[model samples]
Target: MTFSRGAVEEIAAALAASGLILRGGFSFGDDQVAPAGPSGAPAKSVLLVGQAGAAPWPHFQRWLGQQARDIANPLDTWSREVIGAVAQGRGARAVSPSDRPYLPFQQWAMRAEGLKPSPLGILMHPTYGLWHAYRGALLFEDEIPLPDAHVAIHLCDICVEKPCLKSCPVDAYSGQGFAHEACLGHVRGPRGEPCRSGGCLDRNACPFGTDYRYPPEVQAFHMAAFARL
Candidate 1:
């Protein structure tokens, strides 16, 4: 069935109520986003979905165990399964962040929401802060009208203190760009206890959206994943 923006939004809201937020999206003619489709068929548009703060973790944790088999990357696995099911149910195709020839979700997000990056390189959401994440996106053959993207006031621009810079133990993020190796090294070291068991100190230090911070256990899960890779 052909879906209108309102109908798609209803789907988005339903998903959001279950823990995933339809972050935003874009519409393109078939020729524009060609060759990226899972079946190699052109998609008319894509809607981005994500997790904000601790909202999705509880839902995800509960869903994780019911899986019939164990998987290495449970988060990615679950995201694809759930989002794909939803999209398929609605006659759309589901895509993931890990999809080959990766979709530039960050750029898509910026276009979708006119968002700018934080000092730590994470997108500084006006409301969700640095605590949110893009899980996956849905591609549709049916056309949906695009929403107007407006630039929000970048929270980092006005913040003079910039505590995210100083809060990190290893000084991993700065004007020099993310010292990925340095971060991994520190997370593996004894002094990385707080970060290893909790989460990135710099990310947690962002004052704009403290209320939306991921739970320690959730943060620890992601940190552990980063440490392993």
Candidate 2:
């Protein structure tokens, strides 16, 4: 099925109220299979939905305030509720990065947005940098007419100093892959006050996309969640 530009715009407008953005989209190819939808049929296309920086923080905080204090994975819950509504209204299926089967969101993101991984293992955007995330995706059984994918310069390639690899207090990202335990220990310890209250020093050190960096409160929320996990 053909999706008109107006259709895409309408979807964008619906998500904007909740501070979500339509990151990008692509149709499934033979080499890359489409995920199965609720009907057990393969979805023909997918439109990625996400937030840049702290765009969804206010909406999320308001939602959190209204919820039970002990709710688990509140962010994921909010994403599902919001994106699921859009999918229902648009006759599509909603899927998330944290779904049971674990869809290839990272690979799909690379294809859709022409992004590459940074030293921090986050997909580095040319403009948004590391302050963005893929919350969910809208899956349609019909092939949608999406804009042509354009190549973007990998910001990490041009980054000479690679400060993100060196700024962590624990040297968590010491090039041998993330020192997960060491990073976790530091974030939970008394000495981790800076990162716990602010954000990951390594992530914050990246000079790119300074304008889009998340505020301290938002970073604190994410840091707290990471510590819990």
**Which candidate number maximizes TM-score?**
2
Relative to the unseen true structure, what is the Cα RMSD of model 2?
1.1
Point out where model 2 deviates above 4 Å.
Answer: none
* Candidate 2 global CA lDDT score: 0.91
lDDT by residue for model 2 (71-156), tens: 99999999999999988757689999999989999988998998989988999999999989999999988778888778788899
Q: Model 2 residue 214 lDDT?
A: 95
* Position 31, candidate 2: lDDT: 85
Which residue ranges in model 1 land beyond 4 Å of their true spot? Answer: 29-35, 68-70
lDDT of 1 by residue, 1-229 (tens): 6777678777787687559988888777535644345456687677889987888787788888787655688999888877877776676778888988888888888988889999888888898889888888887766677767889789999999988999987899999999999999999998999998889998888789888998889989999989999
lDDT of 2 at 129: 90
Residue 53, model 1: lDDT of 84
What lDDT does the true structure give each of the candidates? Answer: 0.83, 0.91
- Give the TM-scores of the predictions, in the order they appear: 0.92, 0.97
